[model samples]
Target: MKLLLILTALVAALAMPTSAMAAAFVVDDPVDGPGVGDPTDCDGGAPPGNCSLRDAIAAANASPEAANSITFQITALSLTAGPLLLTKPNTVIGQERNTTITWAAGAGPALTLEPTLTGTGSTLRRLVFVRTGGGAAGDPILRIQADGTFFDRGQLRNGPGDGAEVTSVAPATTDNVTFAGSTITGNARNGVRGATGARNLAITNTIFFGNGLKPISLEGAANAGAGAPVGLRVGPRQPDGSLPLSGTATTGGTIELYRGNPFSSASPTLGDSFGVGAGAFSRVPPFALAPGEPLATTLTTGGAGTSEFVLVSVPDDIVSPGLTSVRAINTTQLRMRLSEPIDPATVQAGNFSVEMASRPRAIRSVSVDGGGTEILITTAGGWLEGEAGYLQIGAPGSFADAAGNASLVAGRVRVAAGPGDFTPPRLSNVSVTPKKFCPSGVKRCRGPRGTKVTFTTNEEGRLELAAFKGRKQVGNRSFTKDKAGTYTIKFSGKLRAGRLSAGRYKLRFTMEDEVGNISPAATRTIRALGRKRR
Candidate 1:
């Protein structure tokens, strides 16, 4: 009977929605107590208003209501005293219609988080953190020690040195801590700093208007360990720092692009662009940009800003070069699928080829799916049918910038088909056409004569060519394929004849497959026939 009763309770617990298990807690009371020494405000005696933020944190830690709550709202509380420390898991929302934390001539920080106490759940929202004190050593304003989750929203500004900040002798031991929807400006040092194990830390939608150092700085660990996987994610504020109207994915989630407006919403258009370094950018899927789908976010100009968007999405059919997919068939062969189909005439080894825009040299052969819309491109020559492959697809403009404009917005991919008997070879055939300077076959023609050199392939894709003029470089071109899966490339902008001395120019064209497979150099000998001078 006891076992039966336990099973009944377990079933009941599973029936409850996750929301019922996790709920947000808000602190709006303004009762003020004594200034530390006074017995009246010693324990919980002080009125809510007089009670310092530290005292409130202690009270929340001891409160049974704080555990299951998602957020702790701290309305208008002053930090006139020293630093306010936290060592638990809870969000403190400040900056409501009333109240704030002030810094009148204090030598310490407005908020300080030490190493010993881990802030499992702690946040400072809607509060004004000021540093009116003088001197270079004027409190860091906000010092976050090792370990814990801290969500510091609201406004963090006007400190002698760095504004509301996170400091540690070594990197902290905390894992999931973040700074969002806050304005950190006019400080001496960097606005944010992450060391040793501040793994998975994020600073989003917060403005670093001005600072002596960069707005954000991260020194990742050199090696990897259980608690030491390293990376830092940052982005400007969204329109408003609140939940989206349509119930979008909340901030602080996996998928970086989903966290910010993919369309560069805050700084939308061509001029307002943000650039990520090769290190950070490399960590993301090469084709991170989504074209058509609501990839662009609308910025809210008024109060605070919030960024809430989805990153990984349902597979959709969108036609754009950027929308690409990859299917890895073991280590021998791979296949790539596209949103739209391409012509079979464009698939090949050297002449014209299609390859992954991210790592162009990573693929071997290209073939359009029997239907055209699907492409069967491979990297491993040994792949066979029935084998599975990895797929990575992106939207238009997601592939090449030279094609100029992009068409699709979002893209999707799945391991559709693999090596089975259907697996195809990486190369079909290679061909090259040489342009004759004197089409008339005349030994000599006009001066400064021009010629057209074209390379055509059955597969539709991109090609990289190296042209040599008798071992000397004539020029090189990276060609993009058209919809028909054919790359009809022309190398122009050259004066192969005229005033130049008469001589035989040996031009060699070497074609290569996406998988770094190269075709023997197809050599073409051209005699720069000269004409009599007037």
Candidate 2:
């Protein structure tokens, strides 16, 4: 009959959901207290059990659920009894946010998730663990042995040992641990250690500062074949000090660094202790790191510093040359602005080729501007008005930064014929006056004179004026438009018609648009009438 009852209970337990079977054990004592602390009957005991953290853990283990949670009612508590051994899959949460766990000297870990508890998921959150005295060399404030354990929103500080250690006892078992929104600092050893058989560890939104040793340490077997491959993902560090975000490895492992805004992963320089083996470190895309992106690299040997793989806030080295602005220099010439300087050698006719619905304009030549950041492409023929086409830089590595980092995969940009200013600038209100002078009125001098030509342009462009005596050319002057789109040309002394024998001279005025289109020349006749002495 007892056997039948036991079987019936097992069936009922199996039928219940994991949550239904789970129990919540509460610690009511601010000061360490001792009692049986049976989670199911703590309140039933005479005077009610004290229910210390130690008792709560014990009760959680005794529960039959696969997953249990232990909550504390006290705001502050001290653990004089040493490490609380957790032997089951449990979550220990502080009911009152920011509860403090003070560990006395000689106390082991504040909490040790036993390795013997297979297939358990453990979590520690919203609690502060402060060690008052020194313990063993390798003792950690929190030791995790179960797979899929999480440490969230907690602070582990001032410990004489590591802040946390994650490892698996079973040779074949691998534990995955994650730390989020937590602070691990002031520890004598590494803030977090991943020993043998620990893999897939991730730290996100956490801060590790003032730790005596490296912030993170990965220990693997001396023989590469002896241990499992470990992987670590670290988020960007907060601005506290200049302490570099780094990691140390006793064996082979992989580190993935996530970049913040404006930061990128550069080619890693290996440290002295790092070994070069079959698989050396390599970067993907061979380009600059983008903002808020993660870069993964493998380390085949142990090393002390982050030189194995480090991030730098470098000027964008591998960014593909971007076309910042485009303008039609003329009917057959196009100007393109680049975001950064490009190797002039890479600016080839084939590199700036175009394709369109109609026969694309063949690139006659590609040249870089003096600034080295702009490209001028002269086409074989004028582009049709409103023509649509695609402009692309050739394959990868065709263009590179000064640092020699290859550009990103080239991409095509849609190009459309810009509005062509067919209407040429008008040279209206044109006038040319010659100034005559003499030392004395009686002595009339037939020397040089000052000449001024003023005109207005309906549009912006260059203005050119030429003088001709019959078919023989005399002189010419050119003026560029100012910001207000106005032009004036002046000639003085010998620059003007020097000692001209009063005669009929023809003046020609023409306006050339920015696109090299010339307007009809306007002609004006002026007779250089020599002045007489008064």
Candidate 3:
């Protein structure tokens, strides 16, 4: 009975269908004969009957009941017809370190996986497809239709559609797809294509080279010729003239990175904090400290253990301790230099913190000066100065000491100074006299789009203008100063004639010193004109 079972298995294997082997997983290795049949040995017993790549794929996919089989691994012998096809549900993984599949010149593609997916949950990973032969600019090396999770850490080249495309113009579900660490080069079309309601697709650390279109493109739900509907749509009537919550779909792009602060989330901490010599302390204004400038600055102990001084900035990613310079400037003031120059519009004077290793030695007061370069730090009440401890700074992901630590907020500064002056800029009597379009006591004004407004500050500093219909900033304007701090800019960009919508608009002006500090939002009202033509 056992012999009969073995003979039966052999006969069945010999009688297996040939077309199925051809359309299944086909390999063209010279050693592995280009046929569909189980070899008696791994490499056909060191002869011409070695199992080909295509036969290996067929074996993986063939099940007594399965219409098609799943491919676990394949070792391509060469680039001639090296890529595998997928018309059914399964995964193709390259197993060896140098194992890669290449498509032949004038070949249809490296891999062509059409739709008709069972739409079941399956994961594909650890595979690479290379296009060795040049072809039409728009010819894709790999095309994936319908839906399934496909992950690639591979190389693609020499065509318009070199990478991969997951598109279904027909209304079908293709959700939750992700791509990472892939390089697509010399292509005419985008590397990845998303269509219909394909939401929550994430792409990361993928470099696109020489693609005519955007590296990543989404057709959006509404834009899909026949896909699922998405979002709230009011106007463009559909075929039935019924307003479905689907007019023109759109998709937004966001980057998620495993290395560095590419997402602009948290700032990079401790970026190259090389402590300079004390002599870098003294510098001419427009402080360009020449390299190797010798000066002496010391971190002294008022009493006991060494106290650590740390600095941190606000709105994470602004500056980190490593990227900031904490110079011991006199006993009363410490100058903090930011990693990059900050925009004056986004700065608020009291929004930073300086800390000491000893909580007791934490900063007591912070006085920011103009030019946004220097900060005056005074010891807090709880600060217990020691001889040996060091000081560190921290602020939400903004800045930190050599060792990453959070800096606490102790107290507000008595006054904020300009970058140009240790004394904070002050305004005694400055006025916004409504000129042509303004009416007395009405507060708001309605005038032409390019109406110019003048602001006068008692001291020299930068001025920021903000115009809003309510809380939304419709128009914002800024002007830099040499020594005379005054501004006259048209509230044109933010204030549109059509944006008035028949109501009063709020106007506020803010003043900032060179040191990252800003004054309060000075409030005023301006009546906005309607959208009517003159």
lDDT of candidates 1 onward, in order: 0.42, 0.59, 0.42
Candidates ranked by TM-score: 2, 3, 1
- Model 2, residue pairs in steric clash: none
Per-model TM-score on C-alpha atoms: 0.36, 0.47, 0.38
lDDT of each residue in 86-194, candidate 1, tens digit only: 4445545453343455566444666565554423555565566655553256456676664444555566666766664444544335455567666666666656655
lDDT per residue (tens digit) for residues 1-534 in model 3: 999999999999879875434222333342322343342222324344355555555454443223332232345444343344555444444432334555555445556555554533234444555565634556677665535555556656555464666655466655545565566665556666655445445554454546556455656451232221122222121222221111211222121211122112222221221121222121111222222222111121111101111111111121122234453333334555443222333333345544433333445566543232234456543322221123343323332222222232223222222133334445323344442243222224445443566766656677766565543444455667656555565544343323334457666666666653455456667664544444
Residue-level error in angstroms, candidate 1, position 459 = 55
Stretch of 10 with least lDDT, candidate 2: 234-243
Q: How does candidate 3 score on lDDT?
A: 0.42
| Candidate 1 colliding pairs, count | 78
Write down the TM-score for model 1. Answer: 0.36
lDDT of 2 by residue, 1-534 (tens): 999999999999788776556667777765553443345443336244367777777777776666677777776777765577887775555643788888765467778887643455678878898888636666889888777677888999878788988767766544557777787787888788777666666654555667777566677631223222233322121122111223343344444343431112122222122232233232222233343443333333232212122333433232455567665545666667565566677656776676544567788788876244457777885566555566776765555435444444466766556556645566677776653322122225564444667777777678866666664445555677853345556643222334345567777777767765456567777655455666
